[model samples]
Target: AAALEAYDGHERVWCGRDEERGLVALVGIHNTALGPALGGTRVWPHESFEAGMTDVLRLSRGMTYKAAVAGLPFGGGKAVIIADPKKDKTEALLEAYAEMLVALDGQYYTGEDVGLTLADADFIRERAPNISGTSKGGSGNPSPVTAEGVFLGLKAALAHKSGSDRLAGVLVAVQGLGSVGWSLCEKLHAEGAELVVADIDTDAVDRAANTFGARMADAGDILFVEADILAPCALGGLFSSDTIPQLKAGIIAGAANNQLARHEDARLLMERGILYAPDYVINAGGLMNVAAELAPGGYNREATMRKVTEIPRTLTAIFQKADAEKRPTNEVASDIAMARIADKRS
Candidate 1:
């Protein structure tokens, strides 16, 4: 499978299928030099098993780097369940999937990802202890945590570009009105940043417009909208070859993983004068939040939030390194993360 082709020193890959549950799940552990693999579970209507594995491979690898960059005491891994969350999700199916995760014996810790929610995580946690992000004694919701990190990274980007971190009067066009996007909009709105938001869900769009006073833009137009910052809180591969040239934002930073469709897209962003905040570097808040649950004493909300504040420093360092090296920010970020992983391995 093409997904299984991403074995660039990956630790392990496990494939599971259940005829009774009518489920196909793929789990990939990118690395565990730091600790046991920890990541979220994603459920999507993938076109084929290979496609789902491909997503898992890429996402798991991203998690490895994300955890490494965030300096967490965990490695990176991810799982994908082939099903449409809207229609195929059921208690029995989730429990079955949880059983699969439990079978890994804590090697893979899963929470929630796209098409999956904290509530769904609760379901999995109910079935097994190999899960996190439960409503009780766990990271309640990662969206807000992710939004906080993105906000701080955005400030860092603004400071680098304009010598000011203030968002007041800054225009930010946010794509996606999901949990993370909505929370990000709230943070930006509170700081007096003018918001232009887009989402395929009309209710989400209307809610943002009414609650945050954000202007509405069609999902197709959000990337091209004139703005100082473009926050992509939705899916990945948005800044691909076709869309990179259309991005008008001075700085590109958001919660999306692997925002570049291809690695070279980062260079294109640099060539276009768009300051790109390395996605994993800036969006490690959610990972940091869940990883805190495994700390010696327990999960400390204050400590977790405080640790999130360190994201800007990391972003600043990456920006400086990239600028000095005349390389893409993503490349610098990958190098930094890989070096950390390598250090642990050594």
Candidate 2:
């Protein structure tokens, strides 16, 4: 990082090509001093070039700290293939995408992300060498490990804020019940937390209600629910000015990244006594999990868990620095990460 003075140039290489399935966009090689750049390939519906660029760059930068904070040797990088996964998936399109990744010569490793799946990764892996996250035996989804990180992060945030690790009697409202959110809901339920579950998917809601016995609510109503913790495990920007006033939660910790609508959103939360676990820092478990697998065989799971759990530690340190220095925590954290990059570059 710029402050740590640990690495060299953070040169970003890219490949964008259009075929039958819209665009195959690839951004590669963030920093190699720690090692090659390994990250997931996310396919999403993007309306503009800016959307794709923002996602890849931010996700790449996140990978850096995700690996750094998780103590892995690899640096961070991510690829975004911009298109509607629902409308434009085809064998030919994926094959062309794989050909592009294969051209990278092991410089970039691709896996699964929001709009992508293991099957897609496997398709890409056939043509691209060095890509991973397709399990050898193919046992389960990565959402659980992702959920694990979020759960641990919530525990850390809970302990940091309330001085307790237990979630019993703690009221939690979870947004979305997708793979990761559903997994997180189970964890919260197991911890004895009172749960309010919401999802756009009726099937997912019904399943949670039947299996986990979670109370269901209208999806839009979840953000405004009165609760102890509001986990935005769905999409980003659920914490903007319009929704902040309606929030009754004391804590904002969940799997969603980029939850802030703008820089001022943090101040809003702080004013409301809602300690948000800086979206990227708290939900970094999936990144850490993949990075752990890429490390040498002796990768410590407990150490990895400790690393993810330390997110609150990093966050609290940032908040304390902000308070003493009279700056925003976002400013402080960005300054720290960029300083690490600058130091390393110099």
Candidate of highest lDDT: 1
lDDT of 1: 0.88
What tens-digit string does per-residue lDDT give for candidate 2 at 48-81?
7666766676667666655554445677787888
TM-scores for all candidates: the values are 0.97, 0.84
- Per-candidate Cα RMSD to the true structure, in Å, reads 1.4, 4.7
Model 1 spans with C-alpha error above 4 angstroms:
1-7
Q: Give all candidates' CA lDDT scores.
A: 0.88, 0.72
- Whole-model lDDT, candidate 2? 0.72
The digit string of per-residue lDDT tens for model 1 on 220-296 reads 89999999999998888788879988888999989987788777789999999899998888889988888888778
